[model samples]
Target chain A: MRSHARIGFVLLLTPLVLWLGLLIVIPHIDMLLISLRERISFGVYETSTAQYQKALTEPLYLRTFWRTAVMSVLATGITLLIAFPVAYYIAKMAKGRLQQVLFMFCLIPFYVSELVRTFGWMILLRETGIVSNLLQWTGLADQPVEMLYNDAAMMVGLVYTSMLFMVVPLVTTLESLDDSVIEAGYDLGGGGFSVLREIIIPHAMPGIVSGCIVVFMLSLGNYLTPTMLGGKDSLWFTEMIYNQFIVRSNWELGAAFGFMLLVLSSVIVWGMLRLTGRTLQETMG
Target chain B: MIPTIPQSRSFRLVYGGYVLLFFLYLALPLTVVAVFAFNDSQFPSLPWQGFTWNWFFGDSDPQIGVFHERGILRAVGTSAIVAGCVAMLSVAVGMTNAFLFNRYEFRGKGALYVLMLLPLVIPGIVLGISILIASSTLANGVWDVAQLDIQALRPGLLLVVLGQFSFITTIATLVITARLQKFDRTLEDAALNLGATRLTAVRTITIPFLMPAMIGAVVVAFLMSFENFNTTLMLVGSDAPLTIAMFDRLKEGSTPLLNAVSLLLMLGSSLLALLVILFQRR
Candidate 1:
């Protein structure tokens, strides 16, 4: 009976194992193998880091790689800055029904696909877009200014896309702090900034780190937003990877670019977690 | 200054300004998407010529509404089918995997749990690349070993479903596992002690308890599958999902017809989420 139960448990676990093991693990291993080798011919191949060397040494690839890293970090920082006050309001200030409605308000658009959401931004920011028209109408600008296809536009899209990931964690951590703690700090003659520094921020550090980590990782590896929002000159690294595979049909080169992104993200994520003293398990949710 | 003081003029001003600005930031773009669906302009952006329902319904030159747009209905149909399959399958796999977690004490379970969740953190683009490369490479070997149709092993709807299922199943499992954590398993043991078979106990007691979470998982999986773009873009064959369709239209110079499509999707997702929120409240 015990053996039969063990068999059943094994059976129960098989699908999960088969899925993660087959689709995720095996494929990534294959990709790793592909990255290590150079394509010699149509059917022949080699084992070398030539692809990695190309990715590392090529100026365009290297420049875009660093640019993606820097942009993602900047986007994450901007998202955190914008999200904190909103999260604080929702967590601390709102009443019962108001809180629920506010939370839902933030969530409803998230249900809209990122493609649609980004498209909405496109509509609003394009040369003849709403913002430009409004600017022209109000005499703020002489003619239609191309508000889309710029770094600021890219930053806007990144911040907009990553807002919820930051807000959710911040709210979760902020909600747990007692109201009286802030009140006590204020009563003890702490100014607003000091209270924020000594009481609120320290209390919310875990949430802040988790939100930043998630947002940074997301924006770093993101392809669609940068492409659509940034237009032809976006030069996002993921686009480079896409070009390597789909455009250039260089699978080995694409694989190498992909792992480099993986390493960059992983190392930063690790360092952030260490600095913040948060565990992988805690930050993930 | 106190962060919260209704009496303080500066505090009220700051609070009101912050809330209004942030809410507008969140709501304005989506509002534009919905509003421009009726814009008479040929271009989807601004300079709204006049209001027209033609974008939603008119079928004529320069105004082939979303309904009449070529390949759109088909893309929507494909998205629905794929989402439906992904939802059902991810839930089934998730529940089964949750059983593995909830009903047993085993070695390496912790490690395996982490492994299961690794997909969640890995970027969708990387995940897409890995699956596309590995599956194409292994297709012949898999076909030979299983003696299945070559098409089954190829990149198609099946591959898309599998790629989505990998991460989504992990999510479903996590949801159900959270439910199971608070579960009193003694109820199952009690049922067995009372001479109920294992299957009977699970069917009557465990399943009923899990039904809510299972439903939530199914809803989440469906929505995620529907909206998924990055991973699906890489894995997609000749056929395109709505997202891919929209991206294509962007390249082709789109019309307000795309706005109609976005509005419809937004309405559907909002309605579904409303139902879920209401269901949970009840």
Candidate 2:
């Protein structure tokens, strides 16, 4: 190879490789060591799996583990149900400028920070919030109904936060589908339900799976939303990890819990890929 | 859509209402955030006392508008600094990877690409802790080997920037390389055949085509860095970004001033989205 080209290659490649190595690889390996060992004193330690054992055996941790898993799955399902019609309308039914405008309507709000979005929910859901105030003003109720600080509120927040991710992918796949196929099905004496079930659903399958994976992963790892919306009672697994690191300052346990969360997300993602048969490359976009 | 077929009445009513409500759900929360920023009441929610610009321009004894709040302004400045640096660094690094790995033949190139993306797939909370673990260990290793204090090496804004850059660079790479895949190699070959150097050909032909994606990537990286909370919360020291600053204020029993900040941020983000929409199409 010519010297200039070789030099150009090294200069180009070194930063990325060094960055991934130093930050991504080295840290996680260090995290493994931290999780495996108990700190004896400042800057001293012995290797043990006690943190993982405690995480597995403790009721709070275990309950939180299941709760996070179930909640994330439920949130993913809810987001899918809400996102599908929106994606369909934008991708299949809506025409020209209207399509882009409506889609942007969905996309713009998400451009706001998740913190801002969650706070918006709090403002609307708190006992003295607009919903309660409106309810009382119209004599629908005598008292302000506290809507925030509950599981259902948490779900609403999660669904709102994650709806955009699902919509984009579904639109991508749905747009690729031929309109004539659906028209043909309708001409063959098929009802709307049969046409949709037989044609549209199958065609949008990859998009659906991809959307679910992204939504699931996001909801599972989310900390700020549940903590803010669900109050202190929120049992999100990420919160458990946050408590370990921030509140308790237990690095060992935090590392262990972080590792556990990683494992859970990875396993679920792998299982989803197997079921959906999507390559990692296709889904990454 | 083909726009040839018409829908049934029931179909139109149900799906139309559903879509309208869905948009309402998407938009209502943010509208509330914006509306409350101008609310005269101390608290953001209920019975509108009257409209006031206090949250934006006016200042009272205790709570000043976000524009007048020094602390919030400082955090925004800090956030801008961090995000600007992250955008440049991630784009530079992402461009490098896209050209070298995607365009050239190299052993372990596939594996390296996957490794770069591992950060993207993993929960950012986990990535943040891992950075904390790795950096502290590196500090200790420095202490042991060189007998140096290296207090500057501790977790701070630099660490936070690096931690965010680690994955955001991956996102940048994905965007640029997706553009790179559609590159026409014949142009380079033609340029080389005409006695132009490989570097010059790349600089002229390839890089110009990549301008759109690179700009998009920089925009995305900047936004990601700006709004980032999960990973950043772990690596930060005493210095707080806007998200952390706002969260701290909320946790301390916030007032309408918080809504003002939200309105400003939402406006900034909406403007960015508008830029992307105008420039790039799905």
Candidate 3:
């Protein structure tokens, strides 16, 4: 019977293993190999270290890399600030039907494709957009403001796109908190604010940390929002990688850019694990 | 129970206001897109030029009109077919993996599971380009060995399906695995003890229990495939999926026709979700 079960397990795992091996593991190895190659003029590649040297020393690449890092951090911070209160209210205050409705509302944006959602932002933030028109009408500006095509718009798109991921985990952790714990803190003559500081926030730290990691990873890797919203001048790190392969036909530089991003994110993931005192698997799973 | 201090009415009002505003913020963009679907104007933003169905039904040089435009309709059909095949293939693969991982302990199960999740963590662009290169290389190598000429390996529906299935199956496997963990082995054992073959027991008892999760997995797989852009963008050859088509159109500039398409897609997905809920309730 044990032998039979082993056979069944192997049968089940074979396809998935093969699929990942061919599609993921092999491709990743290929990417690393290609990154080590030098791009020849005819849009072909040859083996060399020149591409890596250029990628490492280039000021353009370095600036974009740091800029993307800063933007991702800022976006993650802003998402946490907005998501926490909404999550707190949903988990601690809302009840029954209201909670379900509010949670559903949080999830509704997820139904729309990210492309459409970003496009919607484009419409709203454009010079002739309602936002600008409102500002103009209120005499807050002499002319319609150009909110689109900048870092601020990019952050808005990223935060809005990733808000649900932040909310869900935060709510899940907060909801598991025992009401009696808060009651006990209050009974000990702690004020609401003090109780939150001493009990609630610490207890909810795991969720906060996990949520931040998720948002940060997503924001760091995201290429679409920054491209569409940030426009020509953005030059985000991912866009740099994209240009290397798609526009410049330089696979090695693109691979270097990709590898740098992978390393950066891995470091962040490692830092988060250390800070939260949980393994990556524990935080994600 | 000790009575809690009643909060001031204003507190409730403030909290309620915040929730309401947040909800509105969430709904605003979608609401704008949906409303603009009915506009007579070409652009999505409006001073209403009166309601018109021409965007949906009109045929012109620039506007294909509604879901009826040849390109839009064709893209939708391609998307649906691709999404359907992807759902079926992923669920089949995922179910097998879930059953295997859940039912038996293997030496390298941990490593295999981690490997499966790599596609999810990697940036979509990276995955897209990697898959394109790997597949094209393999195809080229095969063609070279066979002494046959094949021009390209990356562009086509088959490649798109292959690209999508790579990540989507992992998702399905995760979902089904979660469900499988909760399954009672005793029921299967009881069926086997009652003289059913293992396959028979699995078919009659295990599969029946897993049906709802399988259906949910299918729905999720379909939705993911439908909305997939980054990977599809890189892998797609000639034919464009709705999302890609929309992106192309957006590059040229915005149109109310895209809004119409968005509205229709929203309705289609919601209706499907409602149907799933109803079926589950029954």
Candidate 4:
């Protein structure tokens, strides 16, 4: 009977294993191999270390890497700031149907595509857009403001896109916390601020760290939002990779950039795990 | 336990203001796009001339540029077909994988489960570019052997579906696996103990229990495929999906047509989500 069950399991996993091997593992191995190769004229790749050397030495690549890192960190921080209070309120204050309704409102944006949401921001932030028009009407500025294409716009897009990811985990973690812990903190002569700092934050640390990891990883890899909102001036690292492969047709250089991004993010994930003592799988749930 | 509610008016004002601002930030962009979908203006921006339906169901008029483009409609059709195929393939594969992982444990099970999740961790851009290269290489090699031209072996629909299936299946598998973990094992055993064949037990007991999760997985898979941009952008050949078409149009300076499309897509997805919610409730 045990053997039969094992056979059934193996039979079931056969397709998935084969599919992953062909579509994921093998292709990744190929990407690694291509990264070590040298790119010749007309976008062809030859095996060499020249591309890797170029990627490491180039100031453009290094600058873009640092810029993306800073942007991702800022975005993650901002999202956490905005999401924490709302998540706390929903998990601790609201009850029953009201909580569900509020949560649904928070999740409404997720139902729409990211592209559509970003386009909406584009319209609102444009020089002659609604936001600018409102500012002008209120006599806050002499002329319509140009807030559409900049780092600010990119940050706004990233934070807005990642807020749900931040909120959901936080609410889940906060909801599971023992209410008596907070009550005990208060009974022990702790004020609201002290209770939050001492009891709530520490208990919710896993969720906060998980949310930060998700937002950072997403922002680091993001190409669309920065490209659309930040316009031509935005030298995001992923955009550089896109240019190398798509525009410049340099496959080896693109592969090197891709590999670097993979390694950089892997390190970030590792550091996060080390700091929080939580794996990616735990955070995902 | 409910904490002490803030009774001060100033506290209410501050908290309410923050909530209002957050909602406005979230909803304002979508509202702008939706409103512009009704605008009669040539451009997507403000200064709306009047409300108009010319963009959506209008006669071909090159002068006003009010007509629906045939190209975009074709792209939408292509997107629907591709998304449908991807949803079906991913759900089927994911259900099988989830059942395997949840119901039984065997040697190498842990390794296989981790391997299944590998695609989800990798960024979409990396996946897209790698799949594009691999498929192109395979197609080229096969063409050389078969004495056929590269054009003869179309890498469009098949490759796109295959690429999307790689990760989308992982997502579906995870969802279904979660649901399966909550499944009652005694039901299946009871059916088998009642002299039912093993296949019958699975078909009658296990499948019915999994049906809701299977449906949810399908719906989620469809949405993921429909909104997929990165992988589709790389793998797509001559035909464009809706997202790619919109990207191309935006690059050339957008119009109300893009807003119209967004509104339509938003409505469709919300309605589908509503349907799924209704089904789950039932």
Q: Write the per-residue lDDT of candidate 2 for residues B1-282, one digit (tens) a residue.
A: 235567677878888899998888888899999998988877897778789899988777665888889999999998999999999999999999888877667788777766877787789899989998888888888989999877655768998899899899989999999999999899989999999988899899999989889989989999999999999988888889999899999987768999999999988987887787678764
Q: Write down the C-alpha DockQ for each prediction.
A: 0.67, 0.71, 0.50, 0.60
Q: Evaluated on chain B only, what is the TM-score of candidate 1?
A: 0.92
Candidate 4 is scored at a TM of 0.95
Task: Give one digit per residue, the lDDT tens place, for model 3 in A1-285.
Answer: 779876876787788778888778888788777778875766576888776688778888788889889889999999998888899889888888988888878877877788878878887888877688788879999887889899888988999988998999999998998888888988899876898899888988889888888898888888778888996777788788778767886667777777778778878877877977886555654
Q: Which CAPRI category fits model 3?
A: medium
Which pairs in model 2 have colliding backbones? none
- Name the top DockQ candidate: 2
Residues A1-285, model 2: lDDT tens digits: 579777877888889879988988888999999999998888778999999999999998998998999999999998998898889999988988999889778788668899999999999998999888888989998998999888999999999999999999999999999988888987898877887799998999899988898899899989889989986667799888888888898999999999999999999988998888876667785
Residue ranges of candidate 4 with Cα displaced over 4 Å: A1-3, A40-46, B5-8, B62-67, B143-155
Q: List the candidate numbers ranked by TM-score, top first.
A: 2, 1, 4, 3
Tens digits of per-residue lDDT, candidate 1, B1-282, equal 234632477777888799879999999889998998998988877656898999878899888887887789899998999999999999998998888987788899878877877777788888888998888778756766886667755667888888888788878988898898888989999999999998999899999998888888989999999999878877888778788888898768778888899999999998888777777666
lDDT of 3 at B259: 85
Model 2 CA lDDT for position A153: 95
Report the lDDT tens digits of candidate 4 across residue range B196-231: 988898898888888888898898888878888767
* Better candidate number, 2 or 3, judged by lDDT: 2
True contacts kept of each: 0.67, 0.76, 0.40, 0.54
The full ranking of all candidates by DockQ, starting with the best, is 2, 1, 4, 3
Interface RMSD (Å), every candidate: 1.8, 1.6, 2.7, 1.9
